[model samples]
Target chain A: MMRGESETYGSGMNEDKAQRLEAFEAEALGYADQLFRVALRLCRERGRAEDLVQETYLQAWRSFHRFELGTNLRAWLYRILFNVFNSGRRQEKLNLVPVEETISETIAWDPQTPQNIEDEDVLAALERVPRDYQIPVVLADVEDLSYREIADVLDVPIGTVMSRLHRGRKLLRSELTRYAQSAGYQT
Target chain B: MQVIDCRNYRELLDSYLSEELSVETNHAMLRHTEMCQGCRGEMAARRRLRAVLKRACSTDRLGAEAEQRLRDCLRRETAGGVAAIGWGRRLRRLFEVRGLFHLAAAVAVAAVITAGIGAWLYGAFDGPIARPDLALSPALFEQAAGDHEHCGLKFAVLSGPFEMPDSAVNYDPSYAGLEKVVAPAAAGLELRTVHLCGHKGRQFAHLVYAGEGSLISLLVTERDGKALDMDQIPTDDGIAAGMQTARRENLSIGAFQTTRHVVAVVSDLEAEKNRLMAERLATPLTEHLRRFEQQTAMLSRISFIGRR
Candidate 1:
């Protein structure tokens, strides 16, 4: 009877571990794509981006039991990604220059056009903007993050976020114009 | 009412487009855009540029991916009790680094205080005119002759005080020099006298020459309490006239306003050299106005040719 009780106790422990593992796996799978995209923007390389996302997942899994259920799951994931990016940024020691405003000075086009410039023009233009500008612009315009949310993610002051967004938009506008002109499109 | 330059309207355009401008300003921008071709064109262009950027740099898909990867990584690591224990230890260490954290926190606090003070002063003194570009007036062109009578380019005035920071007058800090910046219109017209007041209390004389086919202006600021000398005046012989009824640097002008006064000449100077010359003249005039303001302690003011 004592031997049988020991076997049951051991089996119970194993089942509890299994259930916890299954729950974590499900949550991790749900957040994989979001992690990958943010990592891609920061790293700017697909493989490295994927690896960063994978690392983030690993970190999340290790801390899963501690996570408060029903909290902002997305915000939590973003904070980790931002930390990873911040660490990488510090290591690289990026020194970025502020963008000038001349790029958007010309070309009077209307916003209400049915179909505007092509996608290739835009992608090509975005590649030219510096990483500092690229990150904020993408998060604000593409991801639709508010200025405050962006400040939280980037871990910078809201003013910095606003300035960066302004500078990035100006640079991108200039690049787009050049791209359009080169593509043989008229003013 | 005249239409101001579209360049000055850039800031307001952004605010208007963002829907961040006050209701009054928004109405002003809309009204101005409807009547002014240049402003309308600029607004259209800015909108287009923003749209182009949006389409070019969409990151919705990327954000989603990043979120997913983060969760995955965290889940996998936490599955192992070993990883959980390590993170718990790291958190404890973070708390232990109290001294270093306090130092960093203090610096951040100082920076925020400084920024806040700077922003507050700028807003309070500027009187809701922080950005000239964003101050585009919404009123449709108010003409003496009704809509059918083609009134030539209405003179839109962008005027303000010429305040001088001490640094500008002492040495020339890059920022201090703006104390002497002025936008004095010098096309050419006969007036008893034109009073161009800087924020500090500098004044100048101006004239508008509204010719049948051309609109010319000549502005003379005081030099040591006297009108500018003849050698400083820009005349028709020196300027090249064109069909848009425009001319470039129609005259070469040199005038000495008092130590507190600077003179500016604005004409239809399309030539690069003429524009530079005008800017040089206007910049000094801005300074003269600054000195005048310091002596008098009066706010910047503008006197219109016809009605206020």
Candidate 2:
């Protein structure tokens, strides 16, 4: 009787485990596209972006048992994404940024200039900013993650995240300005 | 409303543009913006840039194809292929697949061939016999090498013609009637053990010989699995022949096709010497194998009669 009861309990536990796995894919996989977009900006390369997103989801699935029931799931996803991204952080992140692209020489913001740069152009310009300043800018401005969230991803303080975001945006503006001038646009 | 100073307003610019600041801070920032022209202009430009970026990045995503790919990848991960298998067991399963088995077999064959070649190459060489379709079977060399390893190099020096062992009593079914064609070719070497090794339904004569400090072998078979990286050398005692030789690992192999069988001589002999020996044996081999095969049907008939 004891053995039969134990078997019944074991089967119940297995069914519960199966249900959790099913629930995870249904509920959590919605964030995968968002994670991938973030990964694309972070890596600045297509293949690496896919790899990063896959790794993030794979890790999230593996660590699903530790997750609290009802927290900020997106924020949690970002945390995990950043952790995975930074863990295997590339030494040379984006090779698109030219060597001469310091902020002082590139951007001279005038209110009179054309502010009609395309978003793809903006992204291209964004990729040209140095990696140190670029990531926080992407997180705060593009992905809409908070400065605190960026800090968790980057393993830096919130103050540092804000500073980097500001600097990164400034660099991006300058780069877009240079890109515009080169393309013979009035901006 | 309390107006914040420039330093504080500068820090709040990012928050304000992102619209994360509260109404109190927003009101203060507006008041401050009215006062500071430089900060206000910088903030305006940054706000425009941020809006453009936000709009763009919100829509920025993997394409439909990549999305499908990721969906498939996730599906595969969640699919019940082996949910209960632990990490260790899963990895073991990966290795147990047929592709990995083929890879292991190929690698083993390569290692054996490499060891055979290295053994010959490191010691000595002159050149190889330039021959067309002179393919050496690494598998055959490996078989002989295994048998040679089993019995060390203290083997009898072969001289004159040797007797063919009885097939039904001594050899495998696939190898029956094979000894008559093989013994004469092996008779000149410092013969060790005469073996009939069968692999994958193909039969071979694995004739081991004591070669220098290492044991060598002559594996003769009717089937030749075309070898790609065979070394070219002259194989002739005046029969139109081409010799392909190679050193794989510790053994040097010399191969040539006769009228009846594909003959491969693999040994610890120097590359040049191994090929020269194979070349010298070609005439005797061609003659003996042809003569033996001519009588093969008669012998089979006699053996059948004896069995009856």
Candidate 3:
């Protein structure tokens, strides 16, 4: 009698696992566009963005058993995408920040002018900000993660998240200002 | 309401926009904002920036065509086709076959040609060859021991012509076959089984021999892996020797002067074991070289001895 019960329990567990796999596959297909959007924002290329999303989905599918069904799947997928971006391609991580900040102590630049810039120009400028500043700004402004949630995702203190977000935005604004002045746009 | 500086207000703006501020803090921040024009302007600019960024980042604008293609590709990936394996994974799997024959076959028919050439060279050079002293001199050995806590030279000398391209010097798989022939002969020499990475990135079996400290490394690069027709000289103790070859069959040998040592890379010797064993068998090898030199000198009256 005990053996029979154990066999039935094992079969039930197998069925549950199969059902979960099917559900995860469905969710992955459904949210692929959103995941691809986040990856596209980070990578700025279509093929690479698709690869990043696919990698994220595959990882999510494998770990779906561990995912809490009630939690936000979008946030979970975003976290995976961010991790992929940070790990970067097999090649050297390209310094996303513009050449100026990277060589700053070596060279000085012209000061303060505010101007209106195009969205793409602003993004190209935002890329000039260091990743430490980039992460929070991208999360809070673009992905719309809360400051506390950003802290949770980044595994940093909320204070640190606030500081990064503030610094990130300021740098972004300065970059926009620089682009605008160069393009002959006035604030 | 407490008045906060622009810096502190700047920090709160992200939280406020995201609705992350606590009820009391939110209310206080709102009251402060109403009183502070500078903070209000900063907040407005930041909000505008955030809106622009959100709109810019949204890939919904990539539109239906791109989205459909991406979805179709993803659907194919999830449905389990060869596309899901990825290029890198597939390439790695291509080389991961366990058996030797399988790997050789997968590498191409060149293995068969390499085997044939190797067999022919073995047969041709199978004649009586003098053995050199296999171990380093006692003084040099002790010095090498002192400099290195753990050091050994793993060397293989090939007598046959190195094949070209895929079959050349370091790329030749049989180059390491000398180790099996020599290690047992050098028993009690304190040997270590080193991981044999292939020469020119081709895999080979390797070993290192150590007594106290000194190390000598012998590696072969497939001739095809690099441009050929160059000389190699190993110098250590006031003596140097070199070997060069242009054609597959012809090898040039010589003794050279150096500040420290005289080392020779034997290119035409069939057995690396014999080359190393030549030291222990020095009396016979010296006699042979002397006789050979005498005959050459008598024929042309040319000085055959290499000057120090």
Please state the interface RMSD for every predicted structure, separated by commas: 17.7, 18.7, 14.2
lDDT of 3 by residue, B1-308 (tens): 55555556655676788888778778878887998886777677667777777777663444566556544433332332111222223223433432543544444344323433543454422222221111122222222222122212212211111112111112222332444444454455443332222221222223344332322222221221111111211112111122211112222111211211122222233334424433422223223333433443343322212211
List per-prediction Cα lDDT, in the order shown. 0.44, 0.57, 0.44
What tens digits encode model 1's per-residue C-alpha lDDT throughout B40-141? 766777677656666654443435555555444333222322211222233334345647656655654454345335544544212222222111111101
Q: What are the runs in model 3 whose C-alpha is more than 4 Å off?
A: A1-22, A25-30, A85-117, A184-186, B60-308
Better candidate by lDDT, 1 or 3? 3
Model 1 Cα interface RMS deviation (Å):
17.7
Candidate 2 residue B257 C-alpha distance from true site, Å: 42
Kindly list the per-residue Cα lDDT of model 1 for residues A1-187, writing each as its tens digit. Answer: 2323323322222344445655766655665555665566677787667655654554454456678878756666676666545544234323333445454543242122112466666777777888788777766665556677777766777777767776676677667666666666654
**Lowest-scoring 10 consecutive residues by lDDT in candidate 2 chain B?**
B230-239
- Comparing to the true complex, what docking class would candidate 3 get? incorrect
Report per-prediction Cα RMSD to one decimal. 30.7, 22.1, 20.7
User: How much DockQ does model 2 earn?
Assistant: 0.12
